[model samples]
Target: MSDILKGLEPERVFRYFEEICAIPHGSGNEKAISDYCVAFAKSHNLWFRQDEANNVIIRKPASEGYEDAPIVMLQGHMDMVCEKNSDVDFDFEKEGLKLRIVDDMIYASGTTLGGDDGIAVAYALAILEDDHLAHPELEVVITTDEEVGMDGARALDVSDLKAKYLLNLDNEEEGQILTSCAGGMKSRAAIPTRHVEWEGVSAVIRISGLKGGHSGAEIHCGRANANRLLGRVLMNLNKELNVGVREVNGGMKDNAIPREAEAKIVLDPEDIQRAMEIKNEFVAAIADEFAVSDPDIRIELNVECNENRQHTIIHPADMERALFVFIQSINGIQTMSMELPGLVESSLNLGIVRTEEDNVNFAWAIRSSKKSLKYLMSDQLQYLAEFVGGTYWYEGEYPHWSFKSDSKLREVVASSYRDLFGKEARIEAIHAGLECGLISEKMPDLDIVAIGPDIHDIHTPGEHLSIPSVERSYRLICDVLSRLKA
Candidate 1:
């Protein structure tokens, strides 16, 4: 509890947010949260339904005069990505997200704030409880497991929903209506590893302090991918020095940019000093290369001479192949939309890389608005992985929501926003994945547009919510509902 949030408007919404923050609702672990939602609905005596996947939909009848209006659906995911600072000891599945308010922004203490979709849930709850706000019949869909995949939303039986127009409360920006989003798939490459004896001195080369971000949303922002950068260093070292790698690890999640990477390698004792010098030179080059973006990049090496104690190391040939493939993997935005300037049409993220007991696994995410392009990029990644003597597996493949220029609900929302703010609202497409794609697949005629208050650093531990933006967005949504009913 902070002084800043204590005085915010719509105390009920903030109160609910605080309560949710105190609940452990990580993806795939939403039973407690789902039960809470069911209890809330029961206490209100509202009609509700819960699917087998734990998705909950509660119906609130429109105010007296608005019952005849078209039904509107308010949607947001209940589950959140469980991310934390490397040094944080909190367990996401059991520990509540510790929240703090600073300078009007609400953030978690070393863990994700869950504002990505939690604020949406709170806002919906507030609206459901408020009898004063004017609105048409409302259906609030609180879905589960949206972070790992749209499991809940995808599993939901859309036949139960009567809403023809849906407002998704999952967008990160205020005043911007997200009408479409890219389709995405997570691909993994696994290469078998056979460890060999460590015949020389060992040292760990660590890279840290690189600015990592959302692989999809921030891919075009030119932020350096630490995994790719570390691979480059390894490739260069293998060429310049006689070294054997014991293990290489970086990043934990597939969606987040890797902030740190460490490589354990065995090098000739005589080459330790030379290796240190090379590490410094490489760091300097990277700092200069990403000066405009990752200014805080750091690279360091620790030296220790030890006999060949390990049972094995990755074969030299396999290590070279893995490093080369990783370096050659093109990441970030590969194509820009011709119809919309600066919008990413297709992109790839070299997300996670790690060495297991017997194999090395690399993860990637590819997103595109065009279905053909999505598969094209995925095929390319598969080919690249095969070429490197690795196998590729895909998961969480979701379709893109194609933009519709003549959406009636879009027009209604736009007019309402203009009437309230006396200015035009921006309608745009996002590169991030949304459940709207799968929902639309089930309900073809459903008109969907996503909106939300301003939130930053989503899916990361640095996530925060803007209080003022939440107030404004709340008012806008209420006004939009009023106009739709009228």
Candidate 2:
């Protein structure tokens, strides 16, 4: 364990968290972490399996008196979204996260803290390694690549053993017991491009500093997506300057709302001053518009002469249609659930926009609790992409976990929480996607409930894990396990 987290309660859990932080375990890069878990199982004399997808399942037998109890599975994903500040020179593939603590929260230096599911892995590891903990025959299943999509969980084979009850440790908020979660899929539209040589005044117009967050969890916050905002900026400029876009690029993942976006544009030399004035106008307007949700939104500019230097640029006509696809698209909360108060039933986020040589690929992580509404949003995107002569496709589709009305595990968890926290844990459904969705689909008989410590600003560089919440949640988990011995 690192000296900074040495004496924290649940020593084994923090020790394992420090160990996980010391390894590079980002999405699509989980071999090292998977191997670490296998080694732990080997050293602890537990049966384990590591699949080709890098998903690990470590099993421990029940304690002497609890052999008759039903099997329980503790689950979490092994991967973290590798996001960092553009200025930070951190190599996620080569180096581990640099962790720091500010009072009660633990954060990574200019990178994601990985507490979204790392805490889940650490809790499961600590439970598996502790011989005295009164869990039933435990199946500690840790999957990978959950951030991009649930690729690992989708490929997992669950025919080995039986687990009637499964507790997912991937929930972010500490006090909420996630009973249901929305389904999701990746939507990509490759807009075919035609290039032209344009030599004139060129500038890189950037929209940045917006409080980008997870497309699902925080989409309702009314934060401005930098990629879409960039499109709006160009549309405003083209009315006077007739700007031709060279290459528009923004965002990193299909699951995170872009914090920064920039476009290289070609325009007439005389219109340069007008463009600046237009940018300033929109800056003031957007700042006032998103003041409450995205207070730090900014639009910046840097001009240069592209004259005498021929460059490959997209035709102004084609680029204008692409901009329209962004500005006129349906994004954010599409419909609110009347059944559940304050629940978002359907939504989509323009999570990524990239300029390729042949096309500009726009990808979104579409989400909805209702399957019909989910595909309806996809249909809308398809029409927009085809209207602009672009090819549209979708992948990484996953199912949803519905709310269970009769659950013995929920009552056990609630009773345990009240015993420890002096109040009932909030029973609710999150709009975000969870592996429980897929697991419940595969193993329909399993009673699954998702819970976790307080994870703030997940899928972003500002992510932090609450220290006290971890300690409390671990206590509640242990109590629940002890009570489930029947």
Candidate 3:
């Protein structure tokens, strides 16, 4: 347990958060964490179910005289996006996050601080453990594999849940209530590769310093993806200096904007100077192009050449196709919502590119609030990949949670927030994917509203949760629960 959270108000929330951080609950690796939740439920004498997908639903009866009140469901995913700096050697499957508190903000040393949804689990646990809090019958649903996709939510049997009002504690902002979210799918393409031996100079071109962030939330910000930028550099070098690529690798998760990418290439010794010149020009052009969105963007080259050294290079035709996939792939917001000014309606992020042993893989995270638009984007990607000598497929498809014209759950949450803070809370739709969409499909009559404390840089190493906001939000949720009626 981290003593950093000692003496924090709403003590159990922080304590449970630290406890969760001590477990490696990354996406696709939540069995241990799921058992932990079951154990917690058993110790408290609560009814619980652990499904095959590792989703856990614990039932807590209403307190004192609140049994007849409407059943209010608290929902959040148990899995967290596992991302870390390149130099960090932490394993997402086994090792726990090295948590630290600085100036009341909690973060991991060199890895993502899974505060995005972990805090939600912590909040639910704290509320469930407390014997004095007033609330309706509670169905605390802790889901799994939400970062990669809403796998748990998709596989969950919500038929057992009788809760009509659901409070999703998964939003990032403290004062904003998100009632709707964009649908999303992960698209992947595999390009064929043929290796050949060639003697020449070998050098690495790296693009770094881009302010990468969440693909869905920050895609409209014009951040330069390191994978895309590297593609541009390789294309320019091939055109200007006739370079041959050995391998290209960058980006971690499909949901995160790549901050850095590296391409290893082989070229004639004579073209080294020309490649350097083109690299500088491209870097300058990119910096100028994304000056507002990625001011700190940088490009570097590290060279090691030997006249007699032979290196393996991907076949020229295959290399061109791979480069085209990286360069021509559409990224960022594709369309804006006309009805809601300043809202993104459709977008895609070319989030990951890697050179495999026999092929190069490219992946994009596509999102749209409209189902048709989402399918259209996926179709475009499929065509692009098949147009070349590659194959494309989609996975983790989740539905869009459209904004409701009238939601009593939203009304209750907003009114409760205003009553507590003396100010109106913002109601809006988010571009990111949430489990609420799938859950709504399972239980169409469920009225859902999402809220959470302040968390910044989610899905990245800079991710941190605000301690003060957590405490404040804890109080707000308790107040909201007290205010709910049948």
Candidate 4:
């Protein structure tokens, strides 16, 4: 066990958390961790099932006096988003996360901490091993590839399970009970390109230091997207200077806002100083515009003197088409819910832009609670792409987990929180996507409520888990379980 978690309250949770951190379990690469879970269940002499897709279900009988209680299911995913700083050399497929603690929070060195859903797995494992805790028969379902999509939940066979009350341990905030989440789908737009062998002085413009975050949770914050900023700058520069694009690349995941982007362009040597001035002006304007939301936005222009160079540049008209498609498409919170104050009903994120050998691709994620609105937004995106001489498609669509008016699970959890903390827990629906939406579809009769300890800045290298929040949330879960009745 790592000493970073030593002497922490609820030692088992932290122990398991540290142990899981030692195994590389990025999305779609969960075999090692899945087998570790199987070994855990085997060592405990519990019944378990491991599916081909690496989803695991472990069953344990109820503790004394709770035999007649309704069976309870605890669900969390086994995968996490693997992100790192540009200078970091960590590999998610080969190396375990390097754990560290600062200010009572656990973080991974130069990489994402994987605390989003890893904490959930640790909680479930700790609860299952505790012999004295009062609860019904427990069914722990740990799904895989949740960050990429709800593929594991979609493929899992849950018919054999008898649990009807499920507690999803995926929410990031300790005091917020997420009862519903937005439905989402990934869209890809590819614009074909032709190149010509002609070059002048070439320079690369980079945009960085934007406070990128989860595209779903932070889309409404008005954070700057590096990809969008680069596109706008390129278009704006085209109006003043003669420039040809060689490459445009930014972002990695469709669910994360682009934090940094770069574009390589060929320009006349005489326009170098003017281009630098234009870049500085644009940067100043952007910093002022996003001062409140993304105060640390940085736009850097790196120019190298390549004299009489001959390199491939995208055809001028095709480059204009690509830039137009990026600048015109809808990105960020499109509409807010009228019924719920401060709730985002529909949104889009231009999450990634890449320049391939023969084409430039733009990736986006469209989300909405309403199915029609989700498709409508997608249709609009497709129209924008095709209007600019490109083609688009959608994939990995997951449905929304709509809020239920009457929920025994919610009432019990809220009352438990009030009893423990002498205060009310916030109950609301989040705009982010959760696997609960897909799992609820398989088991329509399941009573579900999502809860978790506090994890901040998920899906980014800045992710961290609060130690005190984990202790309080663990106590709350134990209190809720002790109060459960048939």
Lowest-scoring 10 consecutive residues by lDDT in candidate 1? Answer: 303-312
Cα lDDT of model 3 overall?
0.90
* RMSD after Cα superposition, model 3: 1.1
Minimum summed lDDT over a 10-residue window in model 4 is located at: 302-311
Task: Spell out the clash pairs found in candidate 3.
Answer: none
Measured with C-alpha atoms, the lDDT of residue 402 in candidate 4 is: 85
Model 2 misplacement above 4 A? 305-308
Evaluated against the true structure, the overall lDDT of model 1 is 0.85
Error of 4 at 153 (Å): 1.1
lDDT (0 to 1) per candidate: 0.85, 0.90, 0.90, 0.90
Score residue 63 of candidate 2 by CA lDDT: 85
lDDT of 2 by residue, 116-229 (tens): 789999999999888888878999999999998899999999988599999999998887898999999999999888999987777899887888888888988888899889
Native RMSD of candidate 1 (Å):
1.8
Error of 3 at 294 (Å): 2.1
Please report the TM-score between candidate 2 and the true structure: 0.98
Q: What's the number of clashes in each of the models? A: 4, 0, 0, 0
Q: How would you encode candidate 4's per-residue C-alpha lDDT over 359-433 as one tens digit per residue? A: 999999889988999999999988998998799999889999989888889999999999999999999999999
Q: Name the better of 1 and 2 by TM-score.
A: 2
